[model samples]
Target: MGRQRPPRLPPRKMTGSLPTVILAGCGYGAIDALRALKGQARVIAINPYPYIVNSGMSTRLLSGRFSLDLVRIPLLEHIHTNGAEYVQGRVTQIQPEVQTLTVQTELGRRRLAYDYLLVNVGRELRTIAGIHHAFTIRPAEQLLAAQTWIRDCWRRAAQGDPTPGLLTFVVAGGGCTGTELMGELYDLCQEMSATTGIPLTQARWVLINRNRYLATGIAVEKEGQNNRFSRCIETGIRRLGVEIWAECQVKAFGPEQVWLEDGRELLAQTRLWAGGLQVPQWLSECGLPVGPEGSLIVDECLRVKGSERILAMGDCADFAWGSQTRRLPKIGVYAVRQGPIAAQNLLRLIRGQPLIPYRPQATAFVCVTVGNRIAVAKKGWFIWRGYWATVLKNLFDWLYMRNLKPVRWREFFY
Candidate 1:
């Protein structure tokens, strides 16, 4: 089947005298841009509270490590550390014709203009209705709701309740977040069992993906990485004794059960959509040049088409992926790398200098954690595993966050 391209967008004017850079979406990508432009422009960063409902960090949070609040990657705090403005609200509209943005905050409807704009609104999983029991957190409020439900589950488990209830979890995507959630949940159940004595096997752990083989088309040496992830799910379920139904497509949901297309109906408590993210509807509604994924079409220098004054970085921008491909993943790494390049380009454009073409790197820094214990590294032909890989993964996660927004090095040692 041919790929369904994004609708064509009408062009806008290229003139503006605004003294602001409206950086939207405070996820990993947006934060990078915010950090880079700390004192250059009056930046306004927007985002929901560090996200909790995406099910990306379910295991770490559900393990009772101070709940989901502690797990959130706060957008405001990260930016404030580098001296920037933050608006905690939803961006309801963007009007590029006048180079203005409308936001709905607690204070009420507010408007702002931009000299340069970088949209980094991360992505949201596709959530279905009538699946309230399996609530997924995308926004800040949803994470609070999910956390409340978890507390209730813990209460019931502690009471030795054996009733089949609607507190089960089924992750419906097997990408990085899905795999990590499944493995982490397995560990959570084990840890919870020791605390509540409810038998870890009582909780169900399901990876409901459409893919036949896990991580298909993954590199050969990285087979160990893929297998380690698959085995983490398999051995995790075996040792913890949980249930998993792979290659199942969810058709609909009942009050206490979820229906699969293969004539299987499983009693489920919650159905997490780890499947994928779509572009924000508002962007398309703006009639700008957006790619199929709702990513703004930009040149090598990350300038939005038709408007040399406008630029987008991170998830919202559709820049080339690597040295070969013309599309990139919506990963934090891309945003982090692009932040410096985008800033350099924007600065050059501001100073009336030659714009540098963004050269996407050939190799990516990948550290896929199968579960909490193990992770595998892959870059070009390099693939290695075991405790060393996990160590490297931790170091990478730490250094990635630190290097992007450098913190006091003494803190790490102290």
Candidate 2:
């Protein structure tokens, strides 16, 4: 025998021969990986939930048609809350050699040991020059709160004393999140007027896209992209009464407003910064090797460099797919995919077998809800436009959530 390989370790409980597995982050990445682990190892999770709002969907949630809760997967509903141990804390530091993490929780500072460690902690973004800030929705409750504000704004506009900025809801990114958000709110504006009796003129869903054209990535056909951009215009970007500004970068921020690259300035009391996302600072702080974008550079096995005991996935990880270099686009699909891989690799480690590498998909699709019961579906060489696309998109969102971490755990067990 090759020096007698160690036996596959069993999952450690409070007291056991197996070591603990400390998984940070409760996002789709963290929670997904943990759920796939089954009984391979002990697990612990940390996240500041019932807090943070991404605001991408905030405006839509605020409008009261959909609840913010629709966006988040509660950790307790999936993780440690059932039987595993969970610390309502954030991991401030990770030491690989000793395999321990330093965390600050409601109780206080504590160091916990682990046999295997995972860093799924998602990234953070700042708005309004990093002062007086709001966050993306971390829990479902945040959506309900957003609903209240939308109602209040409706009240002001309905009373004929509409605040100058009350009519404006500026979303600043062009990513799928921002794209869907702006488009959703635009639809809500139409619904609010028709249903709540509030005039469509009272609510504005302004999308500030830095790209010269919206859907920059999905615009596969150079002419088709231009045609789609034209369609957005003809599709009532202006006729729907929502303001659309492209290639407008933020020059400066003010307490109550944002100055744009264009000479013409926009002043809105409600400023939402959806201007894309930078990777988290903590990955660098934890002393792991990071790529240019602040994401962790992982080997083919999804293992962080210079450490065999640690792994990364989702938004924080950069893996080589096939081409020059790529991270898995930091989407729900990739995170969900990484979950099973991470779990399998953990088992391989426990069994002293070859670790399996994660493979990327051949293509992906984006389903965006456009106003008037219409949606736009963009995939490689394919575009499904109209109400049917919106219906498909809504159905997809429902089914995806339903199967992955569905409302009922019994389904998973069975």
Clashes of each: 7, 9
List, residue by residue over 17-81, the lDDT tens digit for candidate 2.
45567777665555555666657666776676633233323434634545555544556766654
How far does residue 231 in candidate 2 sit from its true spot (Å)? 7.7
| Clashing pairs in model 1, backbone N/Cα/C closer than 3 A | 53-137, 54-137, 134-270, 134-271, 166-269, 168-269, 321-327
- Candidate 1 residue-wise lDDT, 43-69, digit = tens: 777775533122333344433432444
How much is the lDDT of residue 294 in candidate 2? 83
Off by over 4 Å in 1: 1-18, 29-32, 35-39, 50-59, 65-83, 140-160, 165-168, 198-203, 215-244, 321-326, 403-414
Pick the lDDT winner: 2
Q: What is the C-alpha local distance difference test score of each model? A: 0.60, 0.61
Off by over 4 Å in 2: 1-16, 50-60, 80-82, 130-143, 195-198, 201-205, 215-239, 251-256, 261-264, 404-414
